[model samples]
Target: MRLRLVALAALLSPLAACSTVSEAVKGPELAPVGYPAALVPRDQSVLPLASAREPLPQAASANSLWRTGARAFFNDQRASRIGDILTVQIDIDDSAKTTNATTATRTSGMTAGVPHLLGLESSLGKILPGGFDPANAIETNSSTNNAGSGQVNRSEKISLTIAAVVTSILPNGNMVIQGTQEVRTNAELRQLTVAGIVRPEDISSANTIRHTQIAEARINYGGRGDISRVQKTPAGQSLIERFSPF
Candidate 1:
């Protein structure tokens, strides 16, 4: 097994080097846009489909200007079904601060003696060291002191908006949503993804919802390009740092 692993590593070394070289030369490329299902799988805490559904509408009148099934005018445009689109507004401004301190001290001492063990104290001078004292046969002392302090401060702010699709409807009327947006400027590619569950009642009449209203939300914002590559540590250095003891 060791020999096989060594051979496999040897074979993959060139490929790894080629990948690193290519990335350094060309920077990082953007990922292609795809279906939200690829990002939010069904098993990712998403609820199952509801067994009951609203009945389909009956056919419209033949001689009427306002068709029963038509969305001509004055119809509610809010997203209420699977595949319908809705806007998601995200505005975050969070901060945190923490401080802690600890101190501990301990001291102990012990002594034991056989001062009158069958009158053997007199013979102890001959059997042991000349200054040996039978009254104090064993003595020990110990002391420990510890002190620690820690502090942390952090802040975050983000503001943006994106459209999301209703992927599923739960039995209790909650909808699971997922969306991804990407933009490329020169050699840089920015990506933003959002997925979560929302209640229809929380949605505004304008078909928009706030990030705070989402449950089990997962939001990601990042980019790839020459700037990111320059800021990132090399894979070899990262591996070494991870395995190093100091």
Candidate 2:
């Protein structure tokens, strides 16, 4: 079953916000708007895959389950497949900042590493043919992603993007898509984990930001695992540059 995060995240899709008054004073230049080389705005989002991964023999027969809500704010959804070439773009506004989990201990930058991701993850589930049972077909349990960078400390807002394609599907119904991803990290060590720069061992490294073994504790790190490589955003720009549900 899907590990429901908050009580809302897993259920709701992204909302398109529009019409906001200019908070800053006069603007100098207008930012670029249109299809960039980073993305292929074509007739349709192509996602051609070969096969699925082998089913989880370790998986229990079946079980009943339910979903809960989540507290995710910045996120994206894209149509994906087994194989498709992709490009990515990143943007950041170096002026966004916010309080940490506690004012006594400000977390990373409030707006740094905002994401504009374009990727395809496996839909790990049983193939019932008549669509699928989201409730029964749960993604395999994902371990804590130790993940991240000192960039979380910067007083800024940013967004990054990645492009990928599907490689093959596994028996367990996990779609093996191929695309450049931000990365997943270990929660305990706050080291880079997923696709980006920081290697899993980096976070699994002894000199982690939180300084702990990946097997022992947990770290609530962010930003493509822990690589603090968010790009600078243009002045007077929104936190999220742009995205698609492809």
Candidate 3:
């Protein structure tokens, strides 16, 4: 009976070891099981707010076609107020090329001699071996040459349009903008984000502005899903590579 009990314990030990190994190798949990957290409203504290300023007075004539300090057109579509939305046209084309070269060369020679020092030349033959030239003593010659070259070439282009909202108005009337868009297709989520500051005058009549018109602009485009994972190295392998000497 004791032998049977020992055999049962040995069998269960390997099962427990397998479970532990499985847990360690498991991939991180997929994003939460429901709607993405991005859908929820962002914390108000993170968004920029307009500074307190005295409101501008309205036109003196209520029936006037033009109001003081207002755009001449009544249907102006430019984005100027907080919460107003506008489109941003992104057009990026960049190319760069660089080449570097370095060259170096050096040559040196050294020699030492003792001729007729204290009349030692006459006795040198007796102390030194025959055919040994004192003038050639300690003679040396060296030369070195080095050359290096490097070249780099790169090009990138992106063209798209995304909607942005005015988040704040500066004291000078400039607008701060932030925008985020996500598209999910076949379990993959592609996201694009844009944030910047823009002058109200930069907005075109169609309520659109080019990316270059923005100041302090930041743009990001990427995606995550099974395809993204397949393109990435395994976490365990990556960790090992990070600590490896080679």
Total clashing pairs for each candidate:
0, 56, 0
Question: Highest TM-score among the candidates is held by which one?
Answer: 1
- Residue pairs that clash (backbone atoms under 3 angstroms), model 3: none
TM-score of 1: 0.70
Task: Locate the minimum summed-lDDT window of 10 residues in model 2.
Answer: 210-219
Span of 10 residues, lowest total lDDT, candidate 3: 28-37
lDDT of all predictions, in order shown? 0.75, 0.30, 0.70
Cand. 3 Cα-lDDT: 0.70
Model 1 spans with C-alpha error above 4 angstroms:
1-74
Off by over 4 Å in 2: 1-80, 92-153, 157-162, 168-246
**What does each candidate score in C-alpha RMSD?**
9.5, 34.7, 14.8
lDDT of 2 by residue, 59-162 (tens): 22245222111112221122122343323233445655444342232234222221222421124223335544443433343334343333334554435444
Task: Work out the TM-score per prediction.
Answer: 0.70, 0.17, 0.59
The candidate 1 region of ten consecutive residues with least summed lDDT is 49-58
Better candidate by TM-score, 1 or 2: 1
